[model samples]
Target: MDGYTTALVCAAAAAGAALVRSGKRYIDNSAVELLAAPDGVRAMIEAHCPSLVAPARARLVPPPYLPTGMLQTIYGAMVALRRDSESDIEYDRQLRTMEDGGTVSLDWFPARPSGPECAQPIAIVMSGLGGSAYEYHIRCLAKHLATKSRAGMRVAVLNYRGSGRTPLTSSTMYNGYDTSDIYDTVGYLAQSFPRAPLVCVGFSMGANLLARYLGETGDKSRIAACVTVSCPFSGETAGRAINAPGLLFDKFFQPALTGTIKRIVKRNQDIIQSGAITYDIDAIMRAKRVCDVDNALTARAYGFKDCWEYYAACSSTDFIERIRCPFLAINALDDPIALPEGLPMDQIAKNPRAAIALVAHGGHIGFFSGLSARMWHLQPVLEFLDAVLADKAE
Candidate 1:
């Protein structure tokens, strides 16, 4: 009834909120299961992710004394922010010419040329939604591949059309499920370095595209292996998760989408004026939800009937079973964008060449651990790649 009592009540409420947000169950190693695989791939899975093997439970221990799940996710982002600016890795930038009268930027970090001709495999890295080649995760992976002593591989990060200062010569922009750009990029890489084994690594939306591409091409794919981290298996679930009330995902994404739409609109002003396509630029820019943006801009540009249609066509859930290559798909239980419900766990469990790693708490792409904030997922990824390459050699 008095000021002191009111203040006390408010403090108690805040404490309760904190406790609720911080509370997350640790995943026991016994609960994790490796997807079904054939003899050789199964052996590789056991070697790399033993936790997935039956009776060999492996636990994902969060940093000692730190908050779990959501808190860890936020903390990892903060750590990445601090370290992302200090990257010194240089890239040779090139404009990859596309068949559709468009171009996308590629940042190439080649391995030491003097070592051996095509001795190292080439990794094509794809960035998350609204992400560029210089994104922290992309840069980290590129640097890791380039600097690893045993597997010093060349890295190429693809910047989606109209992203990262890449001009949009055509009116069309990339959507979540589009695989045309990836197809073109891989074609170019295969032709340019005929002797090098190619590997594809994608994060978030890039992962979605990569998964779809793998399923579409199946045994015809030229790449030796593929890895998808934080893929949104179901576009509907991913859209709902990002747009959920009180979450920061939409807040973080909307501004970037607005800017990208604006850039595309400005670049293709002549096309708009000539009535070649219809897009409510103002509505697209003002979109508060990711689905709305996709409907207004992405779907229209790509000729989808609507956002829902676009999401369905782009969702990997429909095609994950068709994936025929050595593949590793990783998703965190607490990832805000890629909800657990979106993953086709049962389907993956049945696929011999595909394995899914469902961690207890690696929020989206924020898989930070220990004092140095190193990405913990990279170890398994590198290990898996090594196993795949070794299997190929045999």
Candidate 2:
């Protein structure tokens, strides 16, 4: 089947899955509907994470024009764009130079005064595509996890090279395919806090990267547990879904993403001009779609023959089954960007170490619920992390 047809089938299947559940709500007023197979992971979640089993119901008020999945996805992004940063949350920046001379910024949120220090649980936050510490979701997750009354966890945000105002020292820039930077960062965290039970939470593109990292590292992974939100499991399906005609989801996202890519390029234009990174600079700057930029730049930079090759090779779908660490993937079936067709449901079900929470509606990273329109996904995340930490402690 063609890409578009495949995406439609996936969407239909997701819709069918949502309806097949027993007519029961876990919690009053909760819009979240969990679709997970019966497994040890699910049992752990049920036993430890009570909030997820019976979360308080919250209302989602989507604007008039933003009704369907396509528009809801855009609306989700718009919400993130409009949110103001938390004033009370601050960071202590630590710049670490990678082996290749590229630099990544690890923004560590201040330690909790009331929380344990000697063996405090550590949570790392990874940003989405073109994301930084400035992104609302990243800040929200970091702050939420670090709350003394809540998780009381030590939190850090990993900003890729050239992101979070980190200078790009090497010719190579960051891409979803390469997990070396994450490998380096994780190594640093493991070494610095040897006794801490390390956990990671990644959103969108970062989620995909985290999944790939977990799968690749397998049993060697130092991370005790992980949660990925809105990950694009199959890049091929996701690319096709976003670029699908008539949906206009691509029309909304492509230009915006390309703009971000262009700005990043321009910031490190000197490195590109040095003839080190072999790509058509003008073509990249003129990219009208996300695919265009990927074809012109990302695919080449990563040594892939083309973007399609890169998409297939880098997609986390192939790696999900190999993941050894306890992992949870949180997704919205209606997310226009991360199409449900790509979710490795079969693989996840087979992997005893993995579980998935497929909500009927959460839009990419925008799981906004409640009358106040706050991020509702944070609750499940906190519950999951808290559960993992507790299980480890015992």
Candidate 3:
């Protein structure tokens, strides 16, 4: 079959599989509940997904509108195909040099209503694995925040070491647990806008980095609030889930990761020939699974013994309780990559400052809700950040 025909067949197969497995149960919402919020805000959320709220706490009686688990998961990936590239959203690119001599790219989109003269709050967005400011979800959220004139929130996205157009200066690539880059980026932002409140919004792997950084820094962290969307709390479990049979998460991720690794190797081929860096370029290029890519490329680059060790060390679940800042974790029960089962819900419940919104439908970072593929999690996130900032002010 031709490439277009192959893509069509794959999409059809995914839709067929979703339909066949429509009734297959996934999330058990009996114990799962929304984070404690004011009755009014709780009512708003419950109006959309009643399953998210406890039966006794729900004020609105709207029927839950969550799509089937399989549909949610499939649409999460499918929406990417239909998404428009937000190329028109302007940004001022800045290269923040890291301590390790490497550099990360930061794209700053100033708020439409507030310019440099105003002390506007900055939202530092960390994109998912191999994602840049150009990715659909990242750009969508950035654009949404930009259009919110009253919010006075500037969007700055941190493109990890090797991703985007940023060249990989160092031999090491970013791992899930590493937060040094974020720390430096936040520090830079703080210096640039000393009075501006720093609110971090991280998606997927970026979420893991933010969570780990918060836990590691505690009260010492400069940021005012944090929101982790679709973070894989337990990397070990998430890795296993992505590798599961018939799941398309690995298929979607592996190619991009492999391509990045290939480019990195090619860029540093001179060092490899000189025996300065030891990387099995052939094995890395041949990697088929996410696990293999992590083991051969990520683990080796980051000084981890193996992929399992890397996953265990990088897992944010271990650091959840250590987080003392006001934090919100939003995870979809149907997320195919970040399995809901791996979330540290118990830890979150114990921390008074930490809250969780366990939505029944958003798959990974895919929370497309309407005909135009509007992100379902955007408003809730904005509301949560507003609440956090208001509490801080008071």
Give per-residue CA lDDT, model 3, range 223-297, as digits (tens): 887889999999898878776656444555556556666776677655433534477777877877778878776
Candidate 3 residue runs with Cα over 4 Å from true position: 1-32, 36-88, 111-118, 247-251, 271-277
Residue 4 in candidate 3, Cα distance off native in Å: 49
List TM-scores for all candidates, in order: 0.83, 0.85, 0.79
Q: Which order, best to worst by lDDT?
A: 2, 1, 3
What Cα-based lDDT does every candidate model obtain? 0.73, 0.77, 0.71
Where is model 2 more than 4 Å wrong at Cα? 1-31, 35-37, 55-67, 81-88, 111-117, 148-151, 273-277
Q: Residues 52-127, candidate 2: write the lDDT tens digits.
A: 5655432233333443455556666665545464424678888899997889988887742233334888888898
State model 2's lDDT.
0.77
Q: Can you give the lDDT of residue 4 in candidate 2?
A: 100
**TM-score ranking from best to worst?**
2, 1, 3
Query: Which of the numbered candidates is closest to the native, going by highest lDDT?
Result: 2
Candidate 2: the clashing residue pairs are: 29-57, 30-57
Model 1, residue 44: displacement in angstroms?
0.9
Backbone clashes in model 1, listed as residue pairs: none
Best by TM-score: 2
